[model samples]
Target chain A: MSVRLAITALAIGLALVFPFIAPNDYYLSVMALVYVNALAALGLNLTAGYTGQLNLAHGGFVAIGAYTVGLLTVDYGTPFWIAFALSGVVAAGLGFFVGLLSLRLKGHYFAIFTLCVGSVITLLIEKWDSLTHGVVGVIGIPAPPGLGPIRFDTSIGQYYLVLAFLLLGLFVMRRIVDSLVGRTFVAIRNSEDLAEALGIDLMRNKILAFVISTFYAGVSGALYAGYVRFLGPDIAGVSRTFDLLSASVLGGLGTLTGPVVGTIIVAWLTQYLQFLQDYRMVVFGPLLILALILFPRGIVGSLELWAARRKAMAEPRAPQAAPLAGASENA
Target chain B: MVIFFQQVLNGLTVGSVYALVALGLTLVYGILHVPNFSHGALYMIGAYAAFFAVNSLGANYWLAMLAAAAVAAIMGVVSERLVFARLKDAPPMHDMIAAIALLLFFEAAVQAYWGAEFHRLAPPFPQIVRAFSLTAPAQRLLIIAAAFGLMLALHLFLNRTWIGSTIIATAQNRQGAALVGIDPAFVSTLTFAISGAIAGVAAVLFAPINLISPTMGDLVITKAFVIIILGGMGSVGGAILGGLIIGFAESFGAFYISTDYKDIIAFALLILILSLRPQGLFPQGAR
Candidate 1:
């Protein structure tokens, strides 16, 4: 626990000082984008990683959240904070209905169903031109309003604002994952039949997990609209969902820190490999397959496994003490 | 009335292609129980294969289609052996993710090789065909005829051939087939090859009517999924019927409603059907 805390402190410390050391506005902006993506990926992790429901419609929820904020602020002239909060609400509301309809589907059916749902969302956004601006997308989204004197017009200010939300998201996620409901989600993921046998209301709990996950996606999307000031139908594209999937899977699903680490690695790789251009997915696709085959546990999960194994090896002299070690490892 | 009949003709043409593609998807799903999301990539590759054969190799349309099927069959076998086969023991989610990755890889690879510009295949049967009050392109009629012909051949092969019986046996009971001395791996490979070939052939027949591009398979593949689900996951006959149903829906929906939202008809039907009867319109094993 102390080691984990120390690492967290060090990481946050680095994040705090990152803007100062970053090369330019581009890097700061990229980091801000990373935080937004991480928040979205974390939301995905709750349902996909821990709950075991592979949601292909996560990007759709993000789109919903983004559009919500975009329309409210741009069209309705709603305040940034109000629109931001409403983004999560609207996404969760949609997620609730989608979940009610889709949670009954198991495995591949569920995934395929969600994929269609996502396409429908994108289609609606694209064809509903009068409302969503069609393929041209929502533009000139207003900057987030300042708090007192802390103006957010600058990249640094926006970066900190996004970072604060990310922290809050992480804190909430930590609480959820550590709570009883989180355990129920894990239970459902492990075995729905077993969880049901234990008197868990499978539908209710699954919907809860899905709704919370979409809420994260929504807030993340709203943040994106604010920072980028541009919203397009492509934001809700299936590719975006795949991006989140890659982050969650590559970083290690079912792990709290995996999404952040995976998002950072993926986001940075994407930035650095811009020269590859169209060839990016050509490289990434195979890499993802290789990663899945080689390290199904993901980076963080594999590291934890390695550490646990090392600890066990070092204490092999005490055979009766193994259970205690295992318990602590779970903690 | 003529226009409605014309729309029906168009629907049948489109439905036949959907049936072909959905048939392939259903076969693989029946045998392996994996959705095979990369099946769309295979379709795209098939179109590209035929495009190269016609444009670069100077093959006729029929010959190009045969070449495409051959190429895609090999690709299907290779992907099954290289990617899906390796992850047989992992969770189903892994198979799906791997399929999605393969999809991304194939799409990007195609884009890299053949730029993103859309290419039009020369129509072999461009003449207009008129029957009574309805007039249509000979290519559309050919598409409908050729798709049905291919489907008939597939039906016969699955029903009459020993290898096809092995595929069916494996789909019904993998372990049982293995116990009966049938190699499940061979069945899997064969199923993938057949699926790939069907997708390839469908692409060749359909590509001339539409523009050929890397993402052309995107919408078709989703519609194929919708058909498979509507027809029931593993039922061959269900795929056929489901394909026709969706084809008619899109045809009428596009004409009656808005063309821009024609694609949504499939998805909307999918959600509605799944909500009402999650098991789909057909029972499993109704082949």
Candidate 2:
């Protein structure tokens, strides 16, 4: 706990000081993007990582959040906070709707269903041009109003704003994962039959995870709209979902800190690997494949794994590895 | 109602393409239990192969199609052997990630080599024919005819061949098939090859009408997935029905409704099916 607190302090310190270190707005915005995606990925980690439900519809939820905020603020003239809160709520509502329909389906079936949902969302955004402005997207979205004299219109302000939400999201995720609800998710992930036989309400728990994750994705999307100040149908595209999945998997599935680490690594690689230009994805593809195969747990996941192994070695006759063997089979 | 007939004809043309693609997806998923997201990339590769054969190598359409199928089949086998074979027992998500990886690699490779522009392959039989108050291009008729031929061949291959029976046995119960002296690994590789070839044929058939692009696979793959889910996962007959349903829905929906919402029809069909008959049109238990 002390180590975790110390790490958290260190992370906060770095984030607070990051703007000064960044050379320009481009880098600062990238940092902002990193935070936004990390928050969103944390949400995704809840479903895909912890709950063992592969939802490609996350990008769609993000889009819904962005569009909601965009529509609310741009057209209705609602305050940013209200819009933000509403966006998450709306996304969660839709998440519940999608989950209610899809959660009963097993494995790849659920995944495909989510994929269809994502595509439909994109299509709706595209076709419902009058509201979303079609491919033109919703642009010129106002920046969040400043708290008193502190204007959030600047890149540093946006960075801090994104960082604050990311921290909050991480905190909430930590709380949930450490609780009974999280255990239920893990139970479901490990085995539905076993979880069912144990009298766990599969439907309710799955829906909760879905709603919570979508809420996070929704908030992330709202943050994205605020940061980027433009919204488009492409935001919900499968490619973005692919990035999230790759990052989550790269960081490690089901680990609390995995998404953040994975996002940072993946975002940095994609952002900084401009020298390769179009060939970056060529490199990215194989890199992701290797990451999924070799370090399926991700950077933080692998680190925790190494630490556990070392501790196990020191303890000598510890039988902890036995249950994990079964858990990993589910993962 | 000539317009309705024309739309039906159009739907059938497009539906045949969907059926072909879905056939490949159903085969891979049925036998190997791999969703094989890269199947679309293979379909795209098939189109590109035929394009290369026709434009670059001076082959006719038929030869180009055969060449496309052969090339795609080889790639399918290689991909399975290298990437998918190791993931036989891994979680479904791993296979999904691997499929995405293959998709990314193939799309990038295709873009690197062919550039991102859409390439067209003119139909060999471009002449229009009028029959029963409906005028249609000969290429459209050819598509339907070819689909029927392929479907017929697949039915025969599955029903009348020893290897086909082995494939079925493996799909039914891998351990049982192995206990009965059938090789699961060989079946997996064979399934991949056959699936790839079918995708190649679909791509070749559709190339004249839709043109070819690296990103085309993404859309078609998504639609094929919808078809698979609608028809019921791992059922060949379900795939055919699902494909035709999608084709007709898109045709009728686009005509009656808005063109923009045509894609939404598939999603609606999927959701409706999940709500009404979550087991799909042809449940695996029935087989």
Instruction: Point to the candidate with the largest TM-score.
Output: 1
Residue-by-residue lDDT tens digits, candidate 1, B68-172: 899888989999998988999877788888898888889999999999999999999889988777799999989888888887888899989988899989988
Top candidate, metric DockQ: 1
Writing each residue's lDDT as its tens digit, candidate 1 over A1-331 gives 6888999999999999999999899999989999999999999999989999999999999999999999999988999989998999999999999999999888788999999999999999999999999998888899999989999989999999999999999999999999999999999988899999999999999999999999999999999999999999999988889889998889999999999999999988998889889779998998999999999889998988887788678765676787887775553
Error of 2 at A101 (Å): 1.2
Cα displacement (angstroms), candidate 1, residue A320, comes to 6.9
DockQ, candidate 1, comes to: 0.82
True contacts kept of each: 0.72, 0.65
TM-score of structure candidate 1: 0.97
After superposing candidate 2, which stretches have Cα over 4 Å from the reference? A316-331, B285-287
- For candidate 2, write residues A1-331 as lDDT tens digits: 4776898799889888988887888988888899999988999999998889999889999999999999899888999879988999999999998999999788888888898899999999999977889998897889988989888888788888999999999989999999999999999998899999999999999999999999999999999998888998999988788888888888888999888888888878877788767667788888887776777677887888787666656765646876875575455
